[model samples]
Target: MTKVAVLGAGSWGTALAAVLASNGHDCTLWSRRTEQAEEIAEKHTNEQYLPGAVLPDTLKADHNLARAVSGASIIVMAVPTKGIRKVCRDLNSVLEGPVLFAHVSKGIEPDTHKRISEVMEEELDREICQGIVVLSGPSHAEEVIRNQPTTVTVAAKNTEHARRVQDLFMNQSFRVYTNDDVVGVEIGGALKNIIALAAGVTDGLGYGDNAKAALITRGLAEITRLGVAMGANPLTFSGLSGLGDLIVTCTSVHSRNWRAGNMLGKGKSLDEVLDSMGMVVEGVRTTKAAHQLSKECGVPMPITEALYAVLFEGQKPIDRVELLMGRMKKNETEDLAGWS
Candidate 1:
């Protein structure tokens, strides 16, 4: 049994801590809210996020970062992408020993457009880090918490690290695949939220399957383009991290990004959506970042660009869809891989 510390106590974090503890690993879930931590420790439940699911009695919460990670061999980061840097900034100073880090959050940073792993690298630096791994795929925390069968990927620069993560989390109802495509995994995991929002917009606009399919297809195109330009294995885009993740995020009702986008498509303003959700809709922030990155890299991400306009520029969602539908046609695979 591995000793695992999950750094976030949100739905995903608690769900994964349950995964570890249920598998007989020593799991400590940490949360910023002391009362919430106390509640989880006492009740073995997180009513705020994972309702109707009883956490393993052994799964506990610790407010102390050092205590949370003391002898743990694996540290899972399930915090939102925006806070990853800060989490690492605090974590680097007091981490007792080197441990494998598996970041499960999705979303690129604004302005920098750095992936989660890259941000972790910047915070901890390579010399201080033991290993970096990413856990991602179509798996949703709601389903995973219910012990549903779900598939995910473990990605790292070293295949060994990937394998280690896979071994750590694999179980009867949960399947973990290992891959070395860190860039593709990170980028695919991050960018799909954007397309998921777009998919939601399609649904909200009352557009049918054809529109959603086209959005998914083109979104994958631009995502792969940026991933290839950034040194990811092109094939990984077709795997669990890329295509698999995109499909799940775009289609799942549990997806916050898609839901937020659907709200926007249904006539709510961005502020209204944010006020109502009160959670990190990673895709909205990520859409802005992707728009900036595509411009910097000269990658044509028309869908992302259009979404950005709607979110930030106050463009009408319907008009954006109209424009996307009227765009000029091109070959399915033409210059899409960034081979030039």
Candidate 2:
């Protein structure tokens, strides 16, 4: 059995660890919280995150970072984007032997504007890191924990590593696909959360499906623009991590980003909304990174700009909507012009 160490123990981390364990991998989930580790190890339940779902019997949990990664073949970094650097630094100090790295967290670092994989590359010791793979798509933790049918893409520069990850997570209930475009996959997955939050704002403002449909479409174009400018394949934006992820996160009730946006639309302050949603809304931080990235790339991401204004500039959601609507009109295909 492949020895896998999944670090995080949040909903997504716990769910993924359960999948690995169910697939017969020797998996250990590491939580920073001692009590959380105790509960998962002893009770086999992560009630706060997974609610009614029970984890696999074979799955294990530990609060000790060294204990979790000890003798592991693969280390899955599932911590939040904000926590990635610290986790990687910790991993570098404790790591021994070569281990394949796969990251499931989606976000660009705000100041460095690095994707999760990029952050890993910068922090991880090159001698020991076998390769970096990214797992991303429309699959949600709530549904996946229940053994529901789910599909996702694993991307890496090394095709072999991507396929290996594909084998690691693929099963009847969990389907996996492989892609070589790491840049495309990471960009699509991270940027979609920004669009989903905007979608949530539309829903909260009592706008109908028409507005959401338009927002999602325009948001994809904006994401594509930024992604391509930043060295991503244009076609990747149309794949699972791109269009597929956008559809799920924007429409599903399980999306924390959307829910946070909904609260913002209902006139709650950003601070209030974040306080209510116990989980981290990745889109908030992603929006900041995207806003800065767009400026750096000289890409016109109006949707991202509007969301940024509402999120950080103290502009009202409704006002931003009007600003978006009143902007200069252009051919829809204009943005896709240079894409070959």
Which portions of model 1 show Cα errors greater than 4 Å? Answer: 125-128, 335-340
**Using lDDT as the measure, which candidate wins?**
2
What is candidate 2's CA lDDT for residue 186? 96
lDDT tens digits, residue span 1-340, model 2: 8999999999999999999999999999999999999999999999989998899989999999999999999999999999998998898889888899999999999999999999999998998899999999998999999999999999999999998899999999999999998999999999999999999999999999999999999999999998899888999999999999999999999999999999999999999999999999999999999999989989999999999999999999999999999998788888889777
Window of ten residues with lowest summed lDDT in model 1:
331-340
- Global lDDT for candidate 2? 0.94
Q: Candidate 2, after superposition: displacement of residue 275 in Å?
A: 0.6
Q: What TM-score, over all chains together, does every model reach?
A: 0.96, 0.99
Against the true structure, whose TM-score is highest?
2
How would you encode candidate 1's per-residue C-alpha lDDT over 115-195 as one tens digit per residue?
888889889855447889999898898999989999999888888988988988899999998888888898999999999
After TM-score superposition, what is the CA distance of residue 15 in candidate 2 from its true location, in Å?
0.7
